[model samples]
Target: MKLLLDENLSHRLVGLLAAEFPDSAHPRQLGLRGASDQTIWDYAREHGFAIVSKDNDFRQRVFVEGPPPKVIWLSIGNAGTSAIAALLRSHAPEIRAFARSAQEGLLVIEKAPL
Candidate 1:
């Protein structure tokens, strides 16, 4: 699934994760630098993107709103961009599986298995 990186993430991550998650984009690159959560949600739903973030807001939305635009919430705290990218790349297969899964809307990834 294509990823819509939240503004909370570094815009540099777009290029960093491109090898595994091609076509992934960041809100900053899409003229959505300061867009509201609702607008980002609407955009991801309209297009085909799974929102990846460290924020709890989107994850909470999934419990109430379900998927069309899936969510990959990075539970790792205060990590750098490369480390975050590595975490995502290491779980590429699982992420792809999550993309195809019918019932799951949220995929939380932390440094330690949780």
Candidate 2:
């Protein structure tokens, strides 16, 4: 699934996770740095991207609005980029399944196994 990495994530993650998340991109790469959450939400909806973020704002938005574009909420706080990448890689299958599902709106990835 294509992911629009929120500004809170390192832009380098785009490259780091590219093999698995082909065509994934960050806001800064799309001239969307500093854009409001709603703006990013709209862009992801428009572009068929699953929004990957550490921000709770997006999670709350999904809870309220439901999904046109799904959300993968990274709950791993204060982790390094490599740790983030590894977490994502470890959960890749689940994330892809979540993306494909019509019923589920949010997938939260925590620091420890859940």
Candidate 3:
């Protein structure tokens, strides 16, 4: 599953979680650092990348429209890289399942432990 990490997330996350998410990329790396939400959404749709973001805007957009590229909305509170990684570790199975299934929607990840 390719993830297009939104600008709200630190670009460092790309390297930190590279092993787990091989095809992942941050907006900065793709020269899309300051792009608008519409641009980001267009890019993800074009490139077949499911967006991973802390922004709630995408969630609303997804509900109104549908998903061409699915979204992993990190609705959790502010956290360090380690905490985010831990969350991903615990939810790896669910993530994989969601990525593979044709069901396109937002995956809201909460702050508390699973």
For lDDT, the strongest prediction is 1
Deviating ranges (above 4 Å) for candidate 1: none
Query: In candidate 1, what residue range of length 10 has the lowest lDDT sum?
Result: 105-114
List the candidate numbers ranked by TM-score, top first: 1, 2, 3
> Which ranges of candidate 3 are over 4 A from the true structure?
none
Per-model TM-score, in order, reads 0.96, 0.96, 0.91
lDDT of 1 by residue, 28-49 (tens): 8899989999999999999999
CA lDDT, every model vs. true structure: 0.93, 0.93, 0.83
lDDT of 2 by residue, 1-114 (tens): 999998999999999999999999999999999999999999999999999999899999999999977899998879999999999999999988998899998999998854
lDDT for position 51 in model 1: 97
The window of 10 residues in a row where model 3 has the poorest summed lDDT is 84-93
Clashing pairs in 3: none
Model 1: lDDT to the true structure: 0.93
Question: What TM-score does candidate 3 reach?
Answer: 0.91
